[model samples]
Target: MTETYDIILRNGRVMDPETGLDRVCDVAISAHKIARVGHFEGSAAREIDATGLIVAPGFLDLHAHGQSVAADRMQAFDGVTTTLELEVGALPVAGWYERQATLPRALNYGTAAAWIFARKVAFGAIELDADVHPIDQMGAGSEDMCWSTEAADSQQTDEIVSLVRQGLDEGAIGIGLPNGYAPGAGVKEMADICDLAFQYGTPTFTHIAYLSNIDPKSSVDSYVRLIGLAGATGAHMHICHLNSTSLMDIERVVELVSKAQEQNLPITTEAYPYGTGATVVSAGFFMEPDFVRRTGSNYSNIELIRNHHRFTGREDMRRAREASPTDLVMWHFLDVDANDEHRRLLDLSVTYPGGSIASDAMPWINEDGSIYEGLEWPLPDQLSAHPRSSGTFTRFLREHVRERRTMSLMDALAKCTILPGKVIESCAPQIAKKVRLQEGCDADIVVFDLETVTDRAEFNAMNRPSEGVRQLLVNGQFVIVDGELETGAAPGQPIRREMP
Candidate 1:
């Protein structure tokens, strides 16, 4: 007698970080959940011959900023099944979620309530644009600049808190605090935000308040304040992109996070694999006169992503910053040396045993500041932007796991999948049912050839898709099959923290 399943993956090397299961096996799925994870006499409506492939939970990105169709396709080719804008989250969380729900995407999606946008709205800095993503709308013009440099008054603080609560009530996963971009947000304001997270039983995803490796208030000082807030309010805190933020001081920053965890503080951190970091020219870090000295990068090392024009001098940098404050600029912090410190630092973040990996992906905007729309797969050659947006996870597996052997494949897989799932599950319990290959888990899975997996996207030619991702599924629906995308599949569902 044979049982039936919606789909059966036969003879694949199944890997589950949660249960330490790593062996060649068969997995059966029914409806949209895993039904069995071992050999079984079963017939299926659809069967995948996943022989010689690594069958693991689909990858989840916690810091993706490109929340559009074009971005989704790029991520799908790289094997990402779910992506969330947790670093610089959306404003008016309901509107963001509603708009996304109406669209067809290649992967599951969600976002946090953006604290920076709330402050912008309260201060009347800039009117929120319905069409643009919240992070793109920020720091674009003179009015938006105030959201970063001007401190909020008491009334404004209250308004910000109210907006955050409204977002939570509307099912936001957590609170996104990109404090580094908004230097004017005072300690009280930040603490109040964390307090709100504590009150609502959610986490706060933060880009630390400072990025300087050294100064009056360095990354160390920033971690102290953030960790202190978590200790005081009992709010879970997630630090974003530690590699770029910590620079030469990554070891110290990691130590601080370790001590906090030792004291049982609910704190976690993530980092991208790249050495160079990108951000808007108008960010507060560029406002400082000694910014170059502090970050150890000069004008020559900075290049505009739109035109690939390198900044020649102080005046050129100033002119560019003033001319287009919102344009993306790349900082070559890791180019100073080649002794593998940058690689080592990145390895430390993924190998920390408690930290997760995030891409901090930026969108591929055209020269006229527009993103491509529609359900086209393998985006056209015209799309160009940060390589990390397309290749972070693939590069991590290729360079760290396969090439360097710094971490086992199973360990690295956990960093990208189950670890981030656990972090989100802390705030949204629904996520606990996702991001694993066990029975009763959501059938979001990836099948890939281990030996040939690698990233092809580079800074010069940025939008290239990866190689060796054979298939990808979201909620048991195939988004990519036989190394090609299944166009027009909108099976991606919203992962939210519905209020109890």
Candidate 2:
């Protein structure tokens, strides 16, 4: 293996859940796959002498917003290898692919077939952008979601479906439903595309509406509806940030889901480990008067991020509220706690006996950089973005498993590795054990300087990169080395499904 191996990472605690091996070993890599994973005497072109460190399969970000070059840079340093961006903002799949030609990336790219946002752009209507019905529990909060665009004729619907089909062809793993908007999709459109996904054998990722801190109805209903959609269409459906919706009732939610699964709902989920949910405040609770009933405050108290108005005084707040009903406002709502009423939301996710974590991260920039205008003055992002952005893995190792002694290290790591890998493989078969590391897998691996590893981003101290993800390899290319991004090693490509 050494003779033909191109690179070898020697002497490290390798944790590969798929292989069920956790011990000190040397990993030999050749031709973009793991050549051997045992004691090695390798003479390779490049060698990382990983003595006393973690040599694990590289982590994949299930959903990321690495749209800009800078955001991609941050993700590499943060320990993300292959990322699928579902925030299908303004660009269609084809245009997004073309734009990637302009940036040098450190990981494999995948997309979501964006129905909601794309329709918003296709039709000049705002209501269609918000998927919530006017009578929904979260209807008042619909201002933040992409509403349904004006009703498209059958021809228009066909064209939109064609665009989504194009996205699937271009390597979009599946459909993305910001279901809070797009109620017009109802059961009909959902069945159509879900059937398409089932035919394609892909997944549909959902951020369901009425799935929030304050739904009088059971959030379990949202899960049931999604399960029904999956049952009807036969598409695998993934719920984003499931723990958030589960709130303090992990047992209840988990029990319901398990029962639904027993009934064959084809539903599954992933969550960020942090206690607090991260979203533009206005999007989730602010604009919703009903949410005001749930969260206890309206737009007046919601923290603003990148408010261009300077949102100087009380007058600015009143005027801006008058101007844009749907301005983007990022808010960090929950404080650190173990057993506060809503605080249990934080508890259930990380401590859940069997749950996976992800960083529901957005690109972090200065108040001016990321925010759209008049939206809301942004929060000073010491750690305003979700903690999972940088802290998900580390929090598990340091705080939960290692420090508190709640979970064993193996279980903690399993949540990070094999569980997510299985889910992604099931969701994105094209990239499956192929582009990522699984056997005949692309040698996308990460060798950690576990001794010094730490997540530096705090609620107020964001923009600080994680320390000691010493070496990162994406498809056998060295993107991070010795501690930082290696200059000029951008070999990532835009993955496509099969064009519509």
Candidate 3:
């Protein structure tokens, strides 16, 4: 007699991105393992009639900030089971783990060290009052993001580097180079850390330094430079938010990067599916006159609807400028009509090589225990811009891949799943395994109502629950069942991707 399985999903279209095969079949799971894959006729204690739903490996978000609970919440609706926080390695690893250990999320998590964050935390001695980057004994600062000054020039950088490696070594899937936001950080700082990331074979996701600075050293130039670094170091460089910065030039930039890749440069990129891009008011776009005018968005033209930290309204934004001139803010940038350069950009990458989807949503908790609020300042448009938090995956699926037919669904899912999974596994061997589903993989899976799903959590969409997550399971426990959140469960697990 065949042993009864724990759960069986019968009569569903199995959309396997891994196999690129779509079929009407039954899928069975027992002991947290994907028990059977083909016309599986097995009895189970619990059975779901997936007649028209799509059963694929839960989607993987290549880029995320790790703040919004909805980040996990949307997983149910978006078919995402594994989500990675590639946010410039902001939080300390141990503390990050400590907090995540308690958050009520419905998924698996992995992270790399934020070299820039560590640099700033360690930058206590650097006098921000001065403009010239603090010169070190080595002089040129960390060459090629190759290294950073000790200030003491001692073992501090070594320590940070070790931590960076340790995070990956400890199971972080990849490295984050929030390089764009940290101009003071030199190339050496990047190169040194990336050397280790390369050594581990983990991909380094970078925010090209020229992202917001679309002048002098424009975003395109920064991307070219990052591509060059990827080629020189033999490091895998994954550019984040390909649509954000001067990303309107993405087509040409993609061609350039692809050309580099023809010569075998380790470069790839991803974008969040939203017209408006967000960043701190202090971001390079704000500093540049052209970017501000082109986007037709300025500090005064924008409102501070959300202040997760000390920054508040326009007055607060102004004061915060005085307070932490380097502090970050999220802003919107997109146009309904393509400018001339944008047309050229599109022509270059009519196929738009290697751009994936990601949400750079940071955890929005304040000292007073609050998530970020939209800007309150009376600006031209009080509209806040962050559709990625809820709708990135769906919009991309529904709009471009499904509606506009920009790319096939298989190509789209590859960006979310196999790509990052393969990238992370390079360093974190545990991720590159057959056991991930062989009854022993950490149970981070999301089951969704593919037929009816919605992601309408815009800043103004009063009282919205995420759309269409039928059943979400993490660590063998259901977090969302019958399209509702299971408020009383500790199914969330922090997937540390390093070695013991």
Worst 10 residues of 2 by lDDT: 130-139
TM-score for each predicted model, relative to the true structure: 0.97, 0.82, 0.80
Report the C-alpha lDDT of model 3 over 1-500, residue by residue, as the tens digit. 67588877778776656667778887677666677767745698988877766655665676666333544654445556666777565335555666666666566666666665555435442321111211111112222222222331335567557657656654566777776656555566667777887787778888777654334677677877787788778888877777665555665576677788788777776666555555544443344445454444555434333433433334555565444443334454444245555434432332355555666643332333233332221111222234565566665566556555777767766666666566566566554432133234444455555445556656453123456556666655666676666655545556565564
lDDT (Cα, tens digit) per residue for candidate 2, span 337-436: 5346544556565555445556666655344323211112122343234445555566556666655677766676666656655655655555555333
Q: Evaluated with lDDT, which candidate comes out highest?
A: 1
Between candidates 2 and 3, the one scoring higher on TM-score is 2
Rate residue 485 of model 1 by lDDT.
81
Q: Give the TM-score of candidate 3.
A: 0.80
Tens digits of per-residue lDDT, candidate 1, 243-290, equal: 888877888888989999999998988888888888776676776788
> Candidate 1 deviates by what RMSD?
1.6
Candidate 1 displacement at residue 410 in angstroms: 1.5
The predicted structure with the larger TM-score, 1 or 2, is 1
Which scores better on lDDT, 1 or 2? 1
C-alpha lDDT values of all predictions: 0.83, 0.60, 0.56
